[model samples]
Target: MKAMTYRGPYKLRVDSKPDPVIEHPNDAIVRVELAAICGSDLHLYHGMMPDTRIGHTFGHEFVGTVVEIGGSVQSLAVGDRVLVPFNIYCGSCFFCARGLYSNCHNVNPNATAIGGIYGYSHSTGGYDGGQAEFVRVPFADVGPTVIPDDITDEDALLLTDAFSTGYFGAQIADIEEGDTAVVFGAGPVGLAAARSCWLMGAGRVIVVDHLDYRLRKAEDFAYAETVNFGQVGDIVRDLKFLTDGLGADVAIDAVGAEADGHVLQHVTSAKLKLQGGSPVALNWAIDSVRKGGTVSVMGAYGPMFSAVKFGDAMNKGLTLRMNQAPVKRQWSRLFDHIRAGYVKPSDLITHRFPLDEIAEAYHVFSAKLDDIIKPVIVPAS
Candidate 1:
């Protein structure tokens, strides 16, 4: 089989590799139909993630068909079309029982903490990912959710990660009807976050980003108002203007980095930072929120040590929720949303490339050129 291989920094290639087989009773072999590139994959493309054996297939968001199943896998069977949750988890683990499937202990024993991710890094389970012909899905019964026959693969693909993470971001924010929400960054996850906020009944969805193309898409799909941070001199001030001198009830830093190094002021309430990346977003959130506000971190962060201002957070009485997606908890619900025509996740996909052209797909997506929002790689049928 020809799989996309990561040689090193700024290096990727589609090369022949051995096919995967079911290695555990809870595992299933999925023949990938459509796999999309995510912004987090940029960590691997830039050599930021811990070392994986050469040729690590780096992708997590995908929808596919079950090719084979392990002896114990019963919920899913051959020919069932399903969306694989990006995180691998065992239903029996301590975290799994608590509905914290992303922190499942049994799936990735090698992780420094509790989490099993496909093709993230050696520190993240070291499992081969879906950016290939086939992928081994552990905890198949608990991970993959079946999509209705009427649902297109393109539409269901985003549910694997981006949409799930976005929904989780909104949920953690505890948003209520008529509350205003702001999302920083216009990447796939950010757009998804904005959409989820709209679904949560937010009165105003403000999307912040430098790119006009992405901000435009956010407006089209999420019905979000756009803010060009590059043009706007200050984020907090602009946010205030947008919110009628009051800060947004919920502020999501989906960018994973501080918004231009300007300290966001707590206006009328504590701000929530839904940014994913490193723990640095924590301090940024503390600075941005109004008193007694929430911060939700939906961005990906791995084992890295950093200092946080616990005093500031405690002083403001901030509510902080930071972690990866509990994919299984919302998998069925998200699929139903798709089936009901409530969310058109496939609209987020702007580019498509054949599996053989995956290397170029990475280049275009990582470069963010040509107005690319999300790129999906399809195996030639």
Candidate 2:
């Protein structure tokens, strides 16, 4: 099997590897038809995430056909086309029973925080991801959902992570009817969150980003207003001004540790690795929302301590909600929205690459070249 292997920071290549076999009774081996390079994958590519070992394959969003299944995997069988959520978990665990699949206690040995995530660093669980011809899915009954015949592969691919997490961001916001919601970052997750805000009855939606291409996509895809943080002197002040001096009702931080804007913060956290992650976007979220508002964080961050604005959030009585999204939890509502033609997850896909060209794909996406928004990987049959 050929897969993208991480060698070091800014280094990746397609290398032949041993095929994965069913290691557990509940496991399933999937022949990956389509996979996606998520925005969060860049964290591993750039050495942002801790314990991302060499030879580790980095991909989480994928849809594939079940080539083989273990005896205990009764929910699916050979030839079943499925979309596997990023999280790997046991359905009967303490957290999983409460619909908190992302925090399942029975999966990762380092289970203090996040549960098992396919292809993320060792901190999240050192499981190989689906950025290859095949992948082994653990607890197959709980995570892999059969893709409906009507759904496109690209759409199902996005649902595995980006779309699901975005909708979860909006879901946690608790947006009231006629409220103004602002999402920071115009990546796929941010775009999805902005669009979902409208479905959640937000009167207005605004997307903030430094890139013109992404901001434009946010405007077109989400039907939301756009703001380039690079153009504004004080983004928080501008957001308050846009909301008529009171600030937005809800502010979301979709840009995590790698956020730009604050030079010192970005340098200390993202560059020097002094802190867990840059809290620029999160701080902006805290300062941009009105008093007694809500701030939802969907961005990926490390387990280390970050210099967050806890004092200001407490002073303003802001509700801060954040977690690795329970992807399967959002599928029922998201499937309905997709079927209703309210949102097309594939529309955000801007680039595609063959499995052989994954290194180039990573370069283009990491460099933000070709106006790339979302890039998909197609493994050879």
Highest-scoring model, lDDT? 2
Candidate 1 lDDT over 159-257, as tens digits, reads: 888878888888889888998877766787888889889778888888877778888999998889998766867666777776676467777756553
Error of 1 at 219 (Å): 0.9
* lDDT agreement of model 1 with the native: 0.77
Residue-level lDDT tens digits of model 2 in 175-277: 9999999998889999999999999999999999888899899989999999987788888899999999999999988888763222223212224434546
Quote each prediction's TM-score: 0.90, 0.96
Error of 2 at 93 (Å): 1.0
- Candidate 1's displacement at residue 341, Å, is 2.9
lDDT of all predictions: 0.77, 0.89
Candidate 2 residues lying further than 4 Å off, grouped into runs, are 259-276, 303-306
Candidate 1: where is the Cα deviation over 4 Å?
257-286, 303-311
RMSD of 2: 2.4
Q: Weakest 10 consecutive residues, lDDT, candidate 2?
A: 260-269
